[model samples]
Target: MTPQNTAGPLPPPTERRRLRQSRSLTHAQLAAQVGVGPSTLRAWESGRLVPHGSEGETYTRLLTTFAAEGVTAVDGPTAGEGASAVEAGRETPQAVVPQPLTPAQAFDELYAFCAPALVRQNYLLTGRPEVAREAVERAFQLAWQRWPEVARDRDPGGWVRAAAHDCALSHWHGFRSRYRRPEPPPADPADRALLDALLTLPPVYRRTLVLYDGVGLDLPETAAETEASTPAAANRLAYAREALAAQVPALAEPGELRRRLRPPATSEEVRAADPEPVRRKAERRNVFWTWAAVACTVTIIGATALAVRSAPTHYEAPIAPAQAVQGVPPAGVMGPLSREERALQAKLRSAAAKGPYRLVPEAR
Candidate 1:
């Protein structure tokens, strides 16, 4: 396995890449073996489909299996077992790579899962934990905006990581900007005093402490995510826990900090509100249907106009004399005016003459 190398909030792509590479099959082959389509395999490999909670473990297993067998399920030995099989077959069997994926290619799949967390990671680092979020977000977007350059690199994750460090450094350089979002002092007199004391701690230590203790990443995981060497990750995790425990009373409570990191109920579901491609297509269909409706309406209107123009004029029938003069006396509601207006207002005149004439105002 690769040494712990990152401490960013996003899940470490490095570890995933190592796991993916350990296998010896292409992505398409793995998908076939796993009963998934080539596109599905690509999505999983590219890290576009992020699994929540147990899904992470499941992905690890799935990807590992695929890497070993290809998408087609013609299987053999598992990791350690496969190595042993190789040793045994050395005498006669030719060395064959059944499954293989490159580190850069694997990381490409991983970026999406951790993309959003780029912001969260920054927020956790630096004493101005509030701004850490913006820094990470900006860093990730900037990296993404330059993806072509990133893709060209052999270690794209490493490249993006270097970019993240540059972003963090810029934040440090612009310390004055941090003051704009002045941090609220702790309310308690003792705690406030301790909080002030915390500011004097070294920047590196503070970052390590906040991530390992403030956030709930286990030391190794934190180290790997943060890009720290294994020993460094462990040391930072220990020191941060100790420092925070010493300063905050609740933090000293058994598992208090850990509980704080995650609420009691954590469903293994990511609230990915982004619509799937299928949904987008459905929306497009609705738009096309709307246009089709307008076109049909225009067609019907045109047909009606054409029929009216084409049809021969003919006098079919006339209303009976008594029925035409039914109730109203021809003046309209305004009462009779002249013979020209009155001739058309015969019904209105009749209604007006009847007196009650309670006309409701129109709603327009």
Candidate 2:
């Protein structure tokens, strides 16, 4: 089925009226089927307003149902389809036509269509089915919360797919997975080996490979989503491809690798997957990291300030040269002694004369 473009405005009133008439149903009946008031239906028919959200979805589905059932009004002809009755010169009932799908319906259809592929991509990236399911669920929940932005996006599927991949690589995965039971490994030996090889690669390399090779994203796109430079992404892809070829030579071909890594289940099977707990956990982790960073910054600043405040200051002073001792003569000196030195020598001699043994001077 062709993917519906949900970003445009509603269909014209004349188109809506023609479809309703072709169904041979009154405006009130059609409105009831579409879960709207008769007046609302009239407004749509008169071009005063248009259906949006779920109402627009209802109109699309109801008209599609009519066209599939071949329901036609007793009128002459329907819209878009040529007037066959006029050519045949016969009066035949007008047939109802399909209306456009609304953004909400289109989003639902996109989720159902892309979820399985996204899950598989995540699974291949992380080597864990449970983690992949968690990732898909979280990505979808975020898409639902931001449907307006997502619907208008150029590649909504790529956006969600990238998000799912990130969720699979979240830092809290280890803590979150502990409480859950482990899923069984893939039955295929080649797949198992491929997954093992993929798991062994660094997260960036693995993600780049998956987005580029597995998901068929171009180098620039992969780089943009992975937040890496284009050159870096290309290098990573080359390394991952070479490593995978070396590890699992049997599945060296890109097509074979994608086939082996494709998701096994449909999105409907895991539609009930819960993402609230995971989202909450991620929020908590972010809060904790923020506070931790703040605490570290404050501690560094405080330590620097304390060190500057407590350091001691020092000053230098000059020292005078040592003075000669009063009774000691200068080394190697034959000159006469100074007045003070002579007086000291006479006192020493007087003391010596009074003692029993006089002191004798030794000549050098």
Candidate 3:
């Protein structure tokens, strides 16, 4: 097969470390690019720790680029020869093409890498194991639904973290009976006290503390993720620290507080769902919403068409109202006759024999 055909997406952790070696780049050189210490990057490659936050994102991107360029593993004489060439003032090792991965492979790798820590962090946010699991799973589902956007994002892990945190802390949970009851506190008194103190702070303060302290994110990164100004994020962090210190005296010092803010031992109770199910669920939900929109559009069109068909086509003139007739005599019973009428009646009787007493019409 051709080198381009063999090239793949980001490799597993071991392969990534080997790929770096194949490129003859030292830990210090790569750590500088990732904005972290060499020891941290070493831990990441050794599988003793997983990189996260902005640093993890940078690392993921760097590895992705390396994969896209088809970096290949080199060992023994090949490695020594590359080092010799470098000592001889060569710019870079000879490039070797490698196999590439599909988008699904990359997504699965990202999910496996981020989900466990996210679940633990979300549990810290909500204090409920079930809710934490639900939040992480839901966030993954959303990420899958918008996979292209997430894959193109600078920090896909952070994107998922924000969604999970928002879901965990949503006020809507209060209305559901399933979530109304509180979870049991940690068995250790100190852990329980710390959790209570954390929960007592406002959600904004709580989130700031978790991002800045619990997740080991720098102030600027925390601020950017929280969508707040640097000063606002600082103030919230300070307020959260003060509240936590007031309740848990052992954590009064910043160093001690940061140490204590690591995922609590009890967080093992929260387990994230597998990535396959989340992806399937996301696809189904997208399809359902698409059909729902289509149905609504069809209903609206039918109603509009019916209205147009039944409406009046032309106008008709209205009739005029009734009025009283003029010059009409009021009729009921008749009154006495006038004198002229009586005189005319007498003349008629006196002049009766004129011509068989023809009756003449008289005005009365």
TM-score each candidate.
0.34, 0.48, 0.65
Q: Give the alpha carbon lDDT tens digit for every residue of 1-364 in model 1.
A: 3232132223335544555555533443343234333344455556666433333444556655534554444356677777887888853334555444463344335354343343333433433444544454444455444555755664454355445544654645465754566666544464444344345555566555544444333455456556788699777656666666777666666366544432311121212222233234444666787899999999999999999999979876877576544676666476548877767688777777676766756798
Model 1 poorest ten-residue lDDT run: 264-273
Q: How many clashing residue pairs, candidate 2?
A: 1
283-332: candidate 3 lDDT, tens digit per residue:
89999999999999999999999999998898867787898899999885
TM-score of 3: 0.65
lDDT of each: 0.50, 0.70, 0.78
Q: What residue runs in model 3 are displaced by over 4 Å at the alpha carbon?
A: 1-96, 263-268, 315-364
Where is model 1 more than 4 Å wrong at Cα?
1-112, 127-130, 152-162, 169-181, 184-201, 209-233, 252-364
Which candidate, 1 or 2, would have the higher lDDT against the true structure? 2
Ranking by lDDT: 3, 2, 1
